[model samples]
Target chain A: MELKGRAHKFGNDVNTDYIISGRHKFKTLDMNELAKYVMEDLDPDFYSKITSGDFIVAGSNFGCGSSREQAPQAIKCAGIGAVLAKSFARIFYRNAINIGLPVVECDTDAISAGDELAVDLSKGIIKNLTQGREIAVKPLPEVMITILNDGGLPAHFRKHGTFNL
Target chain B: MGKTIAEKILSRHSGTETYANEIAVAGLDFVMGQDGTSPLAIRAFNDMGGEKVFDSSKIAMVIDHSAPSPLEGVSALHKLMREFAADKGIKLYDIGCGVCHQLMPEQGHVVSGDLVIGADSHTCSYGAINVFSTGVGSTDLAAGMISGKLWFKVPETFKFQINGKLGRGVYSKDLILYLIGDVTADGATYMAAEYVGEAIDNLSVEARFTISNMAIEMGAKAGLMRADAKTEAWLKAHSDRVSQPVEADPDAVYAKVKEYDASRIGPQVARPHTVDNVSPIEEVEGTLIQQAMLGTCTNGRLEDLIIAAEIVRGKKISPDVRFIVAPSSRQVYLEAMNRGVIQALVEAGAAVVTPGCGPCVGTHNGVPSDGENVISTANRNFKGRMGNNRAFVYLGSPATVAASALNGKITDPRRYVR
Candidate 1:
């Protein structure tokens, strides 16, 4: 699958609380509503600044605190296409994929904010359209690719059996 | 090849030899979801077409995140959980039952070598008692609930061995904070950490729980220790489930081995915004604080309460400070009351609340205002953890929090100990 988007830049250790503060958690469990607050703490104007089909490039250890599924769900529902980080916390990485949110680990320092980029999951290539450069990323495992292709775990489980694993 | 503790446990559960990075389906001894995550898990379960729960007896749900139902929305979520629990016959821990991690082990739902999974990240708390416990998201938890099994990518093991006794005013909280500071937050990502040493062996069960509970902050899948006579005694007293304890082979392969001299460690704290952003108490001392919180699954045990009470028994907290104490579990609350720990804290001007998470998740109770600073015993000082994004949170030992509460500023715990 290929994803193209503008880049939103975040620094190291952008935690869950920063992604969507817990205060906004129970206001509604709806992902779209929660998406309106993604990165609200870090950027109060995040909602107004973000556009659909945009991607985020972050330094190391993005999504570093809490196992809140809302963190990734909010990001995905916020219209961000995928998140490219130097690294992601384990639970966050898993939750993003489970919810069909694409998160790739690659060197993001070279990618600046607002760069238009295209990511190819199967081939592990990211094209910087704005900069005319190509960056390589480690392709996800075949099984993970299958999950992403099916649009997250629920869809994967529906298409396949829940017990297929 | 010799197996690590995680490998040994997973292999036995799966009835197949498992190694690092190998994906396998592991049968669970217990499956859990708290109010914060259960709603999501329930939704996923429905989407995955789950019928009756795979094992009602093995499933557990707790309502501690928004206990007392701070708002109508949370109350409705609680109602939904209650209905689901009643329909499925799953065990439900209602409000005031304490945090899920503390309640699970205290209620005897966990046993050595058992494979447990919870929707909350701190589920690794069970690893303190030598269980193979890890955190999963709602979808993974739903699949486990429906099938009584979940997928795992076996993690490599990091062995931490420490020697010598800790210094005065230092506790397991300090030890863990110091270790995490050294390893950094992502040092153990996707790995299993096994604690072994004279120091760990000498710690009480509650102290062990404190260390393992924060394992998630270090990015470990599970923090493990060898189950010994102490473990056996605790389990026998608390649990009716009988299972032989599992142990790692002496020659087990490990990703790395780290050795430490516990005697050299000092009081520590994880400063605001990042747990890995740690510094010695002396280095960050004298920083002002408006609130001092002492509770949560991490440090709200009876032992922690005792330390807080000891420090503040005769002194009044600074008039400008707000000190709050919430026990980790109902049993702890009852025991603290029976032991007069609660009264002593109250006499020192502490506001003792119900036994639950209590503002640790920024959900309810004692939320800081914008620009306020806090010293807390609970784990995680990430931005907005205490309800306000602009606030600063300093993570410290119960001793440090208690001392700082009295001073109205960050103070080294050692001064009050004597």
Candidate 2:
């Protein structure tokens, strides 16, 4: 499946507290319910029209502070196809991996705002169609790659049933 | 080869002849989660369509974060966590308890030498007991929940060897804030910090916890202390189990080492917008405060209360400033009350709130109005943390916060050190 849309580019250390301030964490349990506040600071209109294919590209240290998983889950549930960042906060990077939201740790210089890119996990490539160029990201290590392929950790566990490794 | 705490634990846990790389992830003994991340994790569980937890009953769960009057999404999230816990027979928790990390050591989940990963960053609070713990996001929680393990890169080590006795008006909060100024926000990024020294040993468990708790604000992976007699004594009072007493080998290698004389450390505060932006209370002297809060997993211990109580004795809170003290736990509140700390605060016009996260996130009580100013002893003073986005937050120690409450402005804590 190809994801296509304008990019939301950000600089380094874009923490969750910055993305959705802790005070604004809605009590609603629904992921779609969280769409109302995604990137509320940068664009209060962010949640209204985040098409299924739009992607969020961050420079580095994305998703820092507070282990609140709502940040990624909200973004994913809001229909963003993937998160492209230079580096990730240790935890959020793992979180996105565990929950099956595609987070690619590639140099974010390849694309700019309004540039459309598609992350092809199966191909280990991000095609920057907007620039008529493409960049490749080192795929997840074999174990994590399998988990991502299985749609994240839970899905992998469900499919394999259990593990001894 | 030098060994950091993260390396020591991971190498030991990974078995000898390990890679000894600080950038590699290691397996964890137990994973922690709370209501804040539990609900979303449960849905991830459902979405994955799983049955049993990936691991045995080695997981710790709590119902903090959105407790004691939650917003819309939070309340429903709490409901789902309970249902998920029951269905999977996961070690679930019910409400009416307190913060997740507070209950961790209380419930005997965070044992010595254990590597723990919690869904919230303050989970670093567990490090007070010699545990290697750090906070991860909900997705990381889901990952650990599914795999029964966590990946941790070995972290660089920063040794904060502090000496000297804490003077009057000086608390662990102040010393730590002073340390943060030197350490800076990203100073210890991806590093494990060891707060060793005479002063730390002299500090109470709550005080040590306060220091270790804020270690994450400096972008640290975890903060550790040598589990000395103080840790032993504190553990005996709280729990009966103690094992894996680890310390740096005398010849242990360190990436960096810092030494501080706590006696010389005075009241420090972080200016608004950044935790690394620290200065003495004297720098921002006379900056009027509209609110003064003394709590959070950071400095909500009994020692913090006593510090505030001593400052407020015979003095009244500024009429224009709302002084709110929310202890980290009910046990802290009870202890403070028995010790007259609560009376000192209340009689001084300070309002005592419940034992939960509020002003820390600016979602609940003590939220300053737009453009107002406040001082707190909590972690992080990011925008809208204690009120409106426009509201200003300055972070100080409990002493600075309490002393400020008396005069309604940032005052030097050293003046009251008598």
Candidate 3:
């Protein structure tokens, strides 16, 4: 599985409230509606600044607060190709994978905003096209890979008739 | 090898020998969701072709995040949850029943040593009773609802050994804040924080709940404490189920261990935009506050309210401050009311709203205005947490918040604790 995108960089401890503010959650649970405000708290022009298939690169502990699926769902709905960070809050990592959003854990110091990059999931490598460097990432667990291959937990369930893992 | 509580509980539920860094498919003893997350779980459950829940009796849902529905869209979502709960014969805690974290334990949905999961991050609060509970997203919650099982990468345990009696006006909230300050927000990512020693043993179940509730602030998957006499007594009073406690072995391996003397700790607060940006009350003292809230899953119990009431019993809060108090549950509310705690707060100019998570999540009720400063007992102080990104939030204990409300500034509570 290969994903190509531009990188949008953020800092450490990016909480869920920053991913999608709780105010928008009060108005709608619709991911598309929430997507318009995705990362709006952190970057007001985030939605308009990037195209589909762009990546959100960040430092450690990304998505650190709340278990609101809207955080990951909004990112996926906004057509983000993946999220790369040094680490992730456990729930957010699980949520992203459950929703079929690729959350890669690797050192993101080399990636900068607007840098063209390609991720090869199977190969566990990130090709920084703009910088002409390749960074290695740990391969996801087999079960997560299977779920991501099936487009997320729901689709995986639809195909397997139960939680395959 | 010795095992920590997390490893033991996951091993028990998974029917395998599990340890840190290993993935285990564990059966859930209970599952829950709140209004903020249940609507999505219901949708995902339906999407996964779920017709009937794995166990209706073990499933619960609460409408507390935006209790009473602040908008038509949210109300529709509430209705969807209602219909779904009815169709599945699951328990539905409608508006005002309480925050799910409080309700789950108070309503007897969980017990010590159980592997519980909820669709809210604060689900880790149940770890106060020795449960290996953690939060998950809606889809994983749906999966748990459908299959009664979910996978977890059993987290390494971080031990916090705190001893010595807490000083006057120094509550568990302060200690937890102090710990968060030392560790930073992501210090314990993917780890279980096991708190023990004299301090924990001496604290009430409610105080323990406050400590465990904020474990996520340090990126801990679960904040656990061994269930002792106090925990057993509280469980006996609040729940009918028998408790089965798990404890880490003496030789249990830990990722890291830190010790603290609680007596040396003072009233602590987390300043604006981040929970880990903590400071002693002296550092943030005299900062003007526009609002002071005294409730949430973090500190809305009867003891917390009683503490606040005692602080502001006969005095009026600052006219410039809009003081709000929301009990964590109807049971706590009724208990406080019968004990005159609510009357004292109201008499002191505090508006006691419905028992649920309203202002804390910025859903409705008492959102702060732009550029306003608010002090609250609830956990988390991230930007936009209170509905206004421009507003500033300070996190403190109930006593601290009440004391600050009296002065309309961030003030230490020790002066008023007597």
Candidate 4:
């Protein structure tokens, strides 16, 4: 798949609590509602600053601590096209893919906030349109690509059938 | 080809040969969700037109994250879980039941050779007992609930060979902290960790549980130990089910192997804001603390409480410190009480709370205010995890917490232990 977006930057170890603090969880579970509070603790004006098709570029362990899938759901519903991080916590990585949120493990050091970029997952290329540079990233396996193509496991299950042993 | 412990268990459940990094479906032996995650799982399950649970007997919901509902929203979520449990006939563990990780093993919901999954990241705690337990998202858990099976990309195993006897001050918590500090948080992402060697073999099941429980700190998919006589005995004592333990093949190939000298390790702690930001206890000694929490699935068992009680026996906590003790489960609480551990702690000015995950998620009971320093036995020292973002949390062993409670500063646990 081909995608283009502006980068939204975050630092290393941007944990689940910072993604969407548990304090707001008491108020609602609505994805959009939770989206409104994403990264509010880190940057109060995060929601106002974001637009559809924006991508998040973060340092290592982007979704560390806590197993709240709400963290990824909020990010995906907030209109993020994809997330490129140095690494991810295992559970958060799985949670993101299960919810059809495209997360890439790539060296995001050269990417800056608001930098225009085009990513071609099919070609394993992340083109920095603003800087005129292209970086290679590992593409998702076919099984995962198929799941993401169907908009996550739920939709995939609806189409194919439940996986049973 | 021989298989690692994780691969063996996955292969067994998948009813086919499995290899590292290969995607396969395995039947689940137990699937669980807590109050925080169950609401979302239930929502996903309902959205998928799930009329009944795949197997109610094998499914469970624990209300421990925000037990007794500190907030109205949490209570509302609890209500939803209660209704769902009743309607689906799934096992329900209500408020004060204890942390899901501790309660699962104590109640025999998880056993050796089982493929268990839960919505809580710490669900990997069951790996201490030789089970292939891993964490999943709510939707993944929902799918597991509906289909009794889940997908996995079998992880390569990192074999950890531990040798040397533990020093007087050293404990499982300290050893795990040292390991995590060396490896960093993302070092083991998407991999299985198989702990072996004389030191691991000599450790108690509780201590092993503590080690395996913190594997997630290094981003491991699961921390596993081979099922030996100790595992079989523990399972026989705790579970009524007759099942064979799973073991790795004699020549199982490991992705990587590393060795450590356990005796060289001293008391350790994870400094504020991140679990892998670790230091020797001496480096952070004398740092003042306002709260000392001794509980959670990590160190809330009977052995841990006894260790705390032994330190606090006939002693008083600092006037500036608020020492809180939370037993892991009702069974643990009752056992400690019967053994006089509760009396020792309470007599030393420690507040004994309900047998649940109190103050771990920052939801209820003993949350630290801004600028407050807290020493705790629970895992995860992330910013704002214990309520205020400004509060500094230091992760340590129960003995370390107890010793620090007495002095209102981080003190060496060895002094008290000796």
Candidate with best DockQ: 3
Compare the candidates by lDDT and give the number of the best one: 3
Per-residue error (Å), model 2, residue B71: 4.7
DockQ of all candidate complexes = 0.67, 0.45, 0.85, 0.64
lDDT of 4: 0.88
* Superior candidate under TM-score, 3 versus 4: 3
Q: Which stretches of candidate 1 lie over 4 Å from their true place?
A: none
Q: What is the lDDT of residue A108 in candidate 2?
A: 87
Give the alpha carbon lDDT tens digit for every residue of A51-141 in model 4: 8888999999899877899999999888888899988887898789888888988889989888998987667889999988987796676
lDDT of 2 at A88: 74
For residue B8, give model 1's deviation from the true position in Å: 1.0
Q: Of 2 and 3, which scores higher on lDDT?
A: 3
- True-contact fraction per candidate equals 0.54, 0.56, 0.86, 0.50
- How well does each candidate superpose onto the true structure, as a TM-score? 0.98, 0.89, 0.99, 0.97
Give the per-prediction TM-score of chain B. 0.99, 0.93, 0.99, 0.99
Q: Model 1 — TM-score against the truth? A: 0.98
Candidate 3 lDDT by residue in tens digits, B1-418: 9999999999999999999999998999999999889999988999998888999999999999998888999989999999999999999999888889999999888999999999999989999999988999999999999999998888999999998989999999999999999999998899999999998998999999999999999999999999998888888988888778998999999999999999999999999999999999999999999999999999999999999999999999999999999999999999999999999999999998999999999999899999999999999999999899999999999999999999999999999986
lDDT of 2 by residue, B1-418 (tens): 5555656777777565333333344577778787667766667656655556776577767775656655655666677777777766667655545566777776677677888888888888878888988988765676577766655556768888998998877778878888887876656766788888899988888788888898887777889987887777767777655668677667676778888888887678899877777887778989998988988888777777887888889888889899998877777788788988899899999898877776677667677888888898888887766647788999988888988888899988767757
| Runs of candidate 3 exceeding 4 Å displacement | none
Give me the displacement of residue B308 in model 4, in angstroms: 0.5
Model 4, runs deviating above 4 Å: A121-124
Which ten-residue region of model 4 chain A has the weakest summed lDDT? A156-165
Interface RMSD (Å), each candidate? Answer: 1.3, 2.6, 0.9, 1.5
Better of 2 and 4 by lDDT: 4
